[model samples]
Target: MPYPIVAAVVATMVLLGIYLSTAAPDLTFWDATELMAAAHTMGIPHPPGTPLWVLVGKLASMLFSSAAPPRAITLLSVWSAALTGGAAAYMAARWLGARGAVVAAVSAGTMLTVWNNATETEVYALSLLVSVLLLVTGEFAGRPDTDDHERRRARALMAFVCGLAVPLHLTVLVALPAAVAFAWRGPRPVWREVVAWVALAALGLSAIAVLPLFSAQNPTLDSGNPESWRALVSVLRREQYAVAGLWPRQAPLWLQLGNVFQWSDWQVAYGLHPFPTAHPVRTALTVLWAWLAVLGLRRLWRHDPRVGRAMLLLVLSASLGVALWLNMRAGPTFGVGLLPKGTPHEARERDYFFVLAFWGWGLLAGAGLSAIASALGRRLPAPVAMLPLALVVVPLLANRAVADRSREPVASLPRTYARLLLDAVPRRGVLFAGGDNDSFPLWYLQQVEDYRPDVTVITVPLLGAQWYRERLAAQQLLEVAAVARWPGQGAVLRSLVIHAEGARRAVRVSTLLERSDRLQLDPGGGWALQGLVYAPDRQLGAGQTGLDLPALRRQRSMVPMGALAPLPPGADPAAQTAQELLQCTQVLGPADSLLVSGCGGV
Candidate 1:
């Protein structure tokens, strides 16, 4: 077989093997659960709906009928990432030969964020694949050997994929300029061809309509309930996250830039933080890595200036360009300096936003590595010469501890927490919960796993949305009374507890909600500490103020939070939970009492 074919196959097998070995075997936290829930049920998700992914994920679920819905749906990300790595390697080999292909495959495949996103059900992996495919198609189409007919067909496909990316994931747009600039370089298409391309593009754009059509059926997890044309427009525009302008940055531009560097530092060295958070050794390694990337760009410029310029546009537009556009809150500027705990205001690390940037670097790094290996080969014995090439294994070995999802119990831990909390609640109880880690997992278990459907789980912060309020009202879970928005959700939550009590339905609260001081769930408010959840206190207004259940408390250990990364301002939750809960609490079967499925009824 030709080198490109060999490269594609080898890269696919290597990356796919690595990904599956480390892949999340079941459900996950954050948007993973929500996205899986939406796709599995053919319902709506958060703003923009991700209709393209939902459709493709649904198809994967159907094809893999033997597997559980969560795992089957998650395969879309896993396979797409492997395919992306293969495609990337193929492109590198086509230009830079076999040595470059090996380096490219390793660099792209083992990127911390890329690897993490691939191991679970998420949009980024598939989105990256689509965008890369578009880039690859455009590059091949513009080749000198390519005929006019082939070029025209390729352009049409590129146009369609570009339009399709809108409903898939908007991050793909970061790649727009480079992909289009090259593909459209030929003689301008006449009005007739232009009209045809536009029509094809419009067809791809039409996929966004899937949201409204699906929402009209009233699916179980409709986020925006975008059944009408107006509602669809709101979701497509992402009204939740959109801002009028880029002024008044979320974090100081300087600090945010530092954050980008810090996260990039972690990409190669995960979980093994050197002393004092920002070790000199790490800074040295990061500088070396940046130099290699620059060297790779130099190689590209020398080898193929035309392609180099396009890929350069890709790197800048993807990395620095995206960072500027995000104006996002500060992340943990770990290596930057000693700043206040709250000084870095980002909720979660924003490294994933620059996925393409890192991916682009992988190609450059491959070129750089190949050049080094060649130089070493000319100066040393064959065995000694290949030593430098072993750096390809560095990422897998170094990043394994943190990026290996198979080892990370974050997936089952949330389900375990949900199991204990739901089991503790009475039948038909209304359970109020907290953030993505707390609430989304419960929804995944209840809706996707078909566990604890008898209990209703409401995310407190979402109560601020009128759509959510109306949805709950329609289900008779809550009434559309005057509401207090999130951060001050206390009043509305208190009213909910009282209303549920009046109806004689048991009301419970998740401890996760305690993260917000403005929300009240206390023994004084008739809530008794029951295991990981707070249950309605029957003895409210009586002499006893606090109540606890020993039987329920025993199950608390089952909730493992070992997957959470350490953030500043306090001791790490993972460490704290391990010491306080995992050490003393009664243990159970599997992984030395680190609950896999859950406490029970999973």
Candidate 2:
């Protein structure tokens, strides 16, 4: 086998082994559930729908049999990550020989961000794989070893791949300037070459059509519903989530630096348990790694200035560029922002966005270590000199235990929540679920596992949008106009109440709105809740109050009062059940105590 092919196979085996040993057995929180569900049902996911991923996931699903849909989707991540590790190893081997390959393998394989994504059903693994491919293809295309014909073909191929990668995950745009800069250094393409590249790129970008194609079938969780050209353009452009108002206000320069500092720490030590606890030791290691990265860049520049400059650009663009963009707050939208008071929020962790930076640093570190080994080889016996390379085991050992999720039952909580919500609502009921955690799993359970086909779940945040309203209208027997009038939670809640009362159907709100103050929940008013609201005619007693646990206890499908916890602090409003549960003095057992203690800001 060829050197690059061998290196790729070795890296793939190593990464796949680790990932399989640690893969999430079932659904994960937030995007994992949604992505898996979307893939299983051939539905479009959140803004800028990943049609390429959906197609790949569907293919993976058919080839791999699993207990559930998420398992199959997670396998896709494993394969992508393994391929990424393989590509990273191949790049190092191609650039710096056998020793460099070893160093790079350790650097990329042990990265926390890569390992984290490898365990779930997210798109980052594929993003990482494509990134490595883009860098490798671009690097190899301009190399002296390649003939003119091959170089031209490689550049065009890189262009096409770049185009495909961008629409798949917009973050892949970080590679654009670097790819272009490297391309300029090579032979200028003639008109035909340019057109060929452009045409191929156009072909690659046509993957967006997958959304409209699948959407026409109306799958269970058709996010964005890109059935028409206008809707297709809107989703592909990410217009819904692209609002400037959704971004948080920019932070002070120092805080932004701190943000970078924290992100740097996470690159290697995120999954390790005791690694973070030993702050002084951990900080020293991180600083040392940064220093090594700098040294490696310097060494690379001395060896090959073009490659060194390319590596530098990759690091800067991926880290600093991404930091500047992410840190800029877009104010507020609907009085809620992604991360209200800046990053480090539990809901949205931004560290994953810089996987490219982590990859760059890993490559640099490998080069630096390889340089050191070369120096040692000149002074000492080869065997004696190779001993220092054993240090690569440090990160591997430290991150292994925490990253190993083979036994972890991550799906339990979401699965339980989905079952509880489904059971709480009556047959063919309309369930007004609160947020991502509250709603996405329901989609997964319903669409993938075939948990409950009758219950209709309307996500609260989507209620404010016309697309979502239209989607709900098409799926359910509800009037979009009346629902759209109230906007926010009020609109959805009122419609559910009216539907329950008039249509003789069941309608249950996951929890009452936090701005319960603005919208009246009185019996005669637009809103009302009694106990769990299991039935249409189950009117609340005078002053019975919102989300009564005692009443919920008596329901046919009982609320697990002992398992409830207070909603964590977020920019979004708190649900009534979660809000009231925080103040509940009743402790059924140790479970409730543990659950209560888990709630922050209680």
Candidate 3:
């Protein structure tokens, strides 16, 4: 069999085997649930909306829609990861040789981050695949052996892929510098070809139109209302997350550099056994990958300066350049970034953004290994030299325990909580869930499993956006009176709660947001339920003032969060719940035992 075919097979087996073994059995936390719900409903997701992924996931769901929607989407990610691994392997073989291809396959197949994402519903795998294809096709276009007509076509196609990538994930743009370098190193460009490329890119980007179309369809699962051109621009531009895309004001330069360094180290050492950054073995392995990448670039330059220059630029551009840019780009990370006071910021993990950089390094690592094989040929027997190559599998062994997440019950914990909350409410009651974790599971249960069709699930934070408000109004979930006070995009969502109360609408609040000041979930003014509150005044209320701890405890579905397992040390549980709520409170959960005064009264 051909080496590329062999590489593909090897990569697929590794990726599929591990991913299947550890895939999420159902919905996951964060965007996983949202994505699954969106795809299942053929609707738009959070911006910049991942329309292409939604389409692909929708197709995947067709095969198992009756039995399991979560599995379908999770499997889609697994398949995408496998494809990415295959493509990575093929690229390595084409660039280096058979041995290098094996190296690349193992590296990508065993990557912890890649494996972690493979078993869930997420966009990274697809993003990785598209990015790798761009690299491969872009390189093929630059090759001297290619014909002129083919080269032009390849360039145009590459541009189209670039445009497609734009709507998928912003991180893919990190490859732009490398793409430019590849073109510069390849054949001279024609103005017509460049123009064609630009036009094709625009044509490809028309996928963004999927948002408005899907939004107009009135799907059971909808996020942003992109039907209007203005809304479309906001969704596509990710204006909702603009603060995150902008650079941080308070972070020091050195801390940002440190964050990048640690992030880079984690990427390289991801799946290595004993792979903690502080561990000596993991540190050495990270250093080895780094050194190999450096050596590989040198080898590439020696072999073909043009190709070498492109690959080098790609590595730097994708890795260091992206790392620097991401570190500089700040938002509430949940707690990943370090503060000047030596404290961690919000806890959201940001390592996923650097996968492309690690991808480039993976290619370079293969080249480096190939170069090593060449050098060892003079001193050692070929078979004996090849024996050392087998050591690359060590990281796979190391990462197995960490990456095996297939046994995790999809949305089991959250689903349990969701069912509890839903059951506690009367039929046709409205439920307000604050953050991704608190809300998306409810969406999945509704859109995928068809749970509680009569009940309404409103994502509170999303209510701030005018597009979202308009969407709610169009769906009859909201009336004109609900949003009359808010006239702008991304406005306060307090009126949503107030409107529901004024209309005598029965509502249930997520424990994560029950005590929020924004929506005024108090006990008075027709908001009589102690388990849930509706503050007509929207004033600062005292702790447990109107909270019904006994009623909350008596509910069969209300499980005490404190009774749950301990959170990781130094990890703030509040930050996770903080996504929707505007302020922290002494009472943390629906039940009294779950209360934490550590939040300090707001």
Maximum-TM-score candidate? 1
TM-score of each: 0.87, 0.85, 0.84
Best by lDDT: 1
Which runs in model 1 stand beyond 4 Å of their true positions?
Answer: 242-244, 274-276, 332-344, 376-386, 408-411, 481-491, 515-526, 538-545, 551-602
What's model 3's overall lDDT?
Answer: 0.64
Mark the 10 consecutive residues where model 3 has the least summed lDDT: 578-587
Deviation (Å) of 134 in candidate 2 = 0.8
All candidates in order of lDDT, best leading: 1, 2, 3
| Candidate 3 accuracy as TM-score | 0.84
- List candidate 3 stretches off by more than 4 Å: 63-67, 183-186, 244-250, 268-277, 323-347, 408-411, 471-498, 523-593, 597-602
Predictions in order: lDDT: 0.70, 0.66, 0.64
**Tens-digit lDDT track of model 1 for 337-447:** 455555645555678898888788766776677777767889889778767667777667766666665653444554555566677677889887766766776777788
Lowest-scoring 10 consecutive residues by lDDT in candidate 2?
A: 567-576
Which pairs clash in model 2? 247-329, 247-330, 248-329, 248-330, 249-329
Error of 2 at 317 (Å): 0.6
- lDDT, candidate 3, 1-602, per-residue tens: 99877877787777677677777776567788889888888877788888988988888889666647677888888888888878777766766676677676667556556666677789988888787778777777777788888888888888898889766886666776676666554557879877998899998888887888898897866665778898788887778765454266335556555555665565444454332335566768878878877888888788767668877887677656765565543324322434444454634556677677666776677667777887887899998766656756655676665565543222254455555556656677767766777677777787777887767777777766666677667655566755545653223344455556666666666555534432354433222223322212223243333344445445523554432433232222332243112111223353434233322112
